[model samples]
Target: MEPLDWNKHYDLANLPKFDMTLCWNCKAPATKVCSGCKETRYCTSECQKAHWKKHKAHCKMFGQMHMMGELPKIMKKNEPKYKGPSMGRCSGCNVRFTPNYPPNDKCPECGYTACESCVVHEVRGTCHCTNHNFGRTYCIMEPRWYHKNGKTGEPYIGDRHPEDPLHEYTPDMYEPVERQCNNCKKITKVFKKEYWNPQRFNTSWF
Candidate 1:
């Protein structure tokens, strides 16, 4: 049997220069190649100079990996190992379900997932999902939904889903506030629940 090429299975192993040819800086079609690595591409000299500060470490590491001839092995090693079952498990209830089962509610930020029942029960009316009993947990909701108010400079709820618990409340009246977690007694940022979108709830509850 022929030896398997692990590089074919790894994403990072396929550098953008070989595929898309996008400039590492401006993301434009790049023709000029990095003299040192010959792998990184740049659209212009200025873009290359500007990106050097950030790309320097990566270029150096790439050179080392290339010289060692272990890039494929390294890429394979770094590939994420998903420990979750093929049938997804709920982050809250830890229930396993078939692949065809209704989609689980997933955290936009961290990609944490929980079944519909556990999500509703744990989140309550607040837009926070309880994971571990840690101090001052981060809000799992999409951060873009919160924006700074013009006058106050405080973060306030922006556009809300149709079924949001506080959808009727305008952004001017209510501001995003901090609340203490009941289990850990730690101050955490909480928002009004957006029921329709990601938080799938039973229809009869309405």
Candidate 2:
């Protein structure tokens, strides 16, 4: 059998630049590449030794790939953008499933989609609105819906009057306020300032 040309498999462009890459052990600029893998770089032998336990499995895998005459294929093919009606890997646990598995919740901040199991068990929390006379405790998960000012698009913290069906609330009266976590009862204080306003109002609950 012809020997496999492993040299062709190494994608050097995909490897992180050695000068900019930091040592896994010390977070310092790496000065030397691992002799076995030629991938992970370290500043000193001490850092390499300190990182050995964590690097051993990766080292072995690289060694196996080298022996197999396969250049490291680290660049993954870009996955097609997810449309509705299909399943994908859960960002939380890295498990891939089909529609049999429940729908995933996408994070507004990072755009990571986690499975329903993770959302329910790991993400769901109770938030308390102290402005309410009874102090309303409500269950909240990722992608929370909030009432934002129509003109400024900034979220307002004031409670809407129950009898005011027309929603006659003024912007000045909607001052920002601290809200508590109903489960832990921890208060998070924020300045009454608008950082980035949402362009569109959230109509999911409406």
Q: Best by TM-score, which number?
A: 1
Candidate 1 differs from the real structure by a C-alpha RMSD in angstroms, to one decimal, of: 17.1
The lDDT leader among the candidates is 1
lDDT of 1 by residue, 54-138 (tens): 7776676556556567668888899885433233776555677666755456544334555667555523111222322111222
* Candidate 2 lDDT tens digits, 1-206: 12223446557456333343878678788888788976677889999998888787667656764555543343233545433222377655667867788545653322445576755542221111222211222222112233332123343343232223544334443335656533335464322223112222244423
- Mind sharing the TM-score for model 1? 0.25
Residue pairs whose backbone atoms clash in candidate 2: 9-71, 10-71
* RMSD versus native structure for model 2: 16.6
RMSD of each: 17.1, 16.6
Model 2 regions more than 4 Å off: 1-20, 65-206
Give all candidates' CA lDDT scores. Answer: 0.49, 0.46
| TM-scores of the models, in the order given | 0.25, 0.24
Note the residue pairs that clash in candidate 1.
none
Worst 10 residues of 1 by lDDT: 125-134
